[model samples]
Target: MSTGKGPVGIITGALSGIGAATALEFARLGASLILADIETQSGDEMITKAAELGGTATVAECDVTDYAAVERLVARTTADLGRLDFLVANAGIAEQSRIASGDPARWARVVQTNLLGTMHCVRAALPVMRRQGEGHVLIVGSTSGREPYVGEPSYLASKYGVVGFAYALRMECAEYGVRATVVEPGTVDTPLTRRPPAVRALLEQMHPLAPEDVARALVFTYQQPPHVVISELVIRPLDEAVNADMPDAEPR
Candidate 1:
């Protein structure tokens, strides 16, 4: 857990699921964190947990969908921590609907949060990282980005955009010593994944990966040497059936 000289990082959507788990994992390694989320109560809880781990943490109430809010979050992190070592663009949302039946409003929300939100974070954080001459950006993509599913066309499109952006960003940031990685996790059993009972039941039967499992993959990427970038990682539960036809779960 003691990653000597731990990094200073920001994790979006740190109130629950993969974001929360990743924050705790980073705390366990003694990293200083800025947990950004709209959920104040849960954000406070995460701060307390980080303290318990002997790590420093602060909560930033940020709605990633808001560019100004996301900008302020990054600004605050640098102002407080003096340097931004990493950014985890893990804040996302999902809804289940077919392309033909999906609500336009819902689709817009999904695109904003899952795609544009990540873009904002990357845009805001890269300059700070460039100034520091080193940093890492971890984009939390999903398996849906890689393959098609039964429902949720909008969600799939957003993730696909994220995956594409992550790679392009990686190349763009390499010269500045900033690393970018996209983590595509399949069937993670988190609050985000448990919204629909039908999809949840199907996932449970397959023993979905835990939030902690995905967190581990993230931490592994962060711990690597600056010269090495694990550009993209696809993690799925053992025995998970890829392309299984199940009801679409929530977007995030």
Candidate 2:
């Protein structure tokens, strides 16, 4: 920890995209952070940047898809920081193919990273939070979770699971002073979204939400009074019409 004076937090997938943005945002708040991800170089870069922003941070090389790895990351955070105040289950992957032609292997990776990965992080953190009698868990879901679309079948399934998982986790942990929030962002301009050529083409026409936009929402949700929980937050770009068409469908 860089000795910053704020609650300690662990952000999964903290090296890039929305996760990176969220880490930077929290750093601006002087929060202590465990930037968890599989990318070491990016993590180091983020740590240096975080220090520049007046935040204390360290990188934890973690593969969120592995339950044991996630458990260890949670344990390590509390040991090094002395307390665990918040966790952002933000690690995820996306596939652009439809169910009929999509590779099952890719779909499996998507579910493991997006859905089970969230579950592992939350489950490991809950006990720690309950012991302290306070904590917050923020799961980054996609707008795809709430609506149907032509493509991205696996991604949709995973995110939908995330939404339900967050709600159920909220109910289970609220009494213990732990909070769970699901953040669903519509179209965001991130590497994941830009990877698909079709989505990249659409990005040229509309001003999609930036990664920082969703990061701000996460910070806002996390900074709320402990007693108040913003259960769900859905954000989309103004030009991203609701229930539009395949790919741009529903700001997902």
Best by lDDT: 2
- In model 2, the runs with Cα more than 4 Å from the true position are 2-4, 248-252
Model 1 stretches astray by more than 4 angstroms: 1-4, 248-252
Model 1 deviation from the true structure expressed as Cα RMSD, one decimal place: 3.0
- Put down candidate 2 lDDT per residue, 1-252, tens digits, no spaces: 444568899999999999999999999999999999877787778989988987888998999888899999988888888889999999999887766667899999999999999999998988999999999999999899998677888898999999999889989999999988999999999998898777888888899999999999999999899899999999999888788655632233
lDDT of every predicted structure (CA atoms): 0.89, 0.89
TM-score of each prediction: 0.95, 0.95
lDDT of 1 by residue, 37-117 (tens): 878787667778997986778888888889998888888778877888999999999888877667999999999999999
**How high is the lDDT of residue 200 in model 2?**
88
lDDT for model 2 comes to 0.89
**Which ten contiguous residues of candidate 2 have the minimum total lDDT?**
243-252
**Residue 167 Cα positional deviation in candidate 2, in Å, after optimal superposition:** 0.9
